[model samples]
Target: MKLDRKNLLWEGSRMFLPEHRRALLQQRKNATKLAVPKIDEQQLETMTYILQEAIEYEQPVLATYVTTYEVTCFCGFVDKVNQMEKYIQLSNGSQTEKIPFYLLVDVTWP
Candidate 1:
């Protein structure tokens, strides 16, 4: 049995009232427009150093990073860094998060 994606989407949306649909769309738009702060070169270098040290020593670090969806404060061991990919991987024992370098707001060493 083939399910038409367009039809399925339409049918699923039919379950939502007009007000619910409007609110859901508004939330999506706002989530996509999160503010990202700008950092000067010195601050960037400091954060980079903290990350490098943590990665080198396998130590946990506290860092504040943001994204289009939300900002997160994480204390975790640095697992990997990919400068070309512009991202870093952090593992906090419970979960590992992939953070974009541009979204990093701050880093404080332990």
Candidate 2:
């Protein structure tokens, strides 16, 4: 049986044996076990500062980011570690908005 990129179990779904079903369930369980480091308020503030600095210097801020909120009920785990970019923008009233990369949970400034 081949699972497609869309996660559709095709080719033999209509004739899946009991063991196959169990295996599929186990795979889902394992996928849900992925975990991410917790992000506190202080950390968020710190990240914002780092983002601001990067934007000011016109440099990319690489970080191991994670999701701060669950977008779906079955999304049990936080986001995976990935690189991100940050920048600053001018908002209304001439205020500077530090656009920190969304869903960034961790960071390591170079």
Candidate 3:
């Protein structure tokens, strides 16, 4: 059967492509929310101290944080730490990323 071009153009093919629309919607739903891990008080304090030391001495660190789909890892120098803002900035020579405290799972420093 030949598809109607007017319907395709107006409806953008999604109406005819239910499977594709379902898959796209599922992907969007999976990425829309993140399951951030729960960090206790002691762990939080330790991570804060490690970040403070790394930032003060200008040392690079490897940190792992939880994303929606996986655990993301980053290796860079801790440039700034703001307790008031509850975020830490990391620089990897080319770019900087501001990661919130709740997302950080592990921090490895030298």
Candidate 4:
């Protein structure tokens, strides 16, 4: 192989080996991960109130929550609030999702 700058380093290398490919994909995925936003006391109280309203009035809400990798928004009604376990159950029509209170970012009437 010629000693050109572009070819010198990878003269006989398998640049896309499975192990290297997997590592590169993992790094890319991690780069896109989102950090959780901080919720102040007033904001927390507002979200709590919205959840309570949803429960009492049987109304739907738009809830935004976060995870390690992404922020998710769900539209549903509050089904249950388990304070001891620190999670709330949200139900759309056919399915229900359990979301931890700590992960909640925002709640709005919808």
Give the residue spans of candidate 2 off by over 4 A. 1-32, 35-37, 67-102
TM-scores of the models, in the given order?
A: 0.70, 0.40, 0.69, 0.83
Order of candidate numbers by lDDT, starting with the best: 4, 1, 3, 2
lDDT of 3 at 11: 70
Off by over 4 Å in 1: 1-17, 24-32
lDDT digits (tens) for residues 9-83 of candidate 3: 877535557888799989898877768888888887887788888877888988889877778888899887788
| Root-mean-square deviation of candidate 1 | 10.7
Maximum-lDDT candidate: 4
The predicted structure with the larger TM-score, 1 or 2, is 1
Q: Model 3 segments beyond 4 Å from truth? A: 1-20, 23-34
lDDT of 2 by residue, 6-95 (tens): 545464556878998999998887776644556888987886676566656655444554433332111111122224554323223333
lDDT of each: 0.85, 0.49, 0.83, 0.89
- Spell out the clash pairs found in candidate 1: none
Better of 2 and 3 by lDDT: 3
Task: Specify the poorest-scoring 10-residue window by lDDT in model 1.
Answer: 7-16
Highest TM-score scorer:
4
Count clashing residue pairs per candidate.
Answer: 0, 0, 0, 0
Model 4 Cα lDDT, one tens digit per residue, 1-110: 65677866777785578998899999999999988788999999998888888888899999899988988999998888999999989999998989988899999997
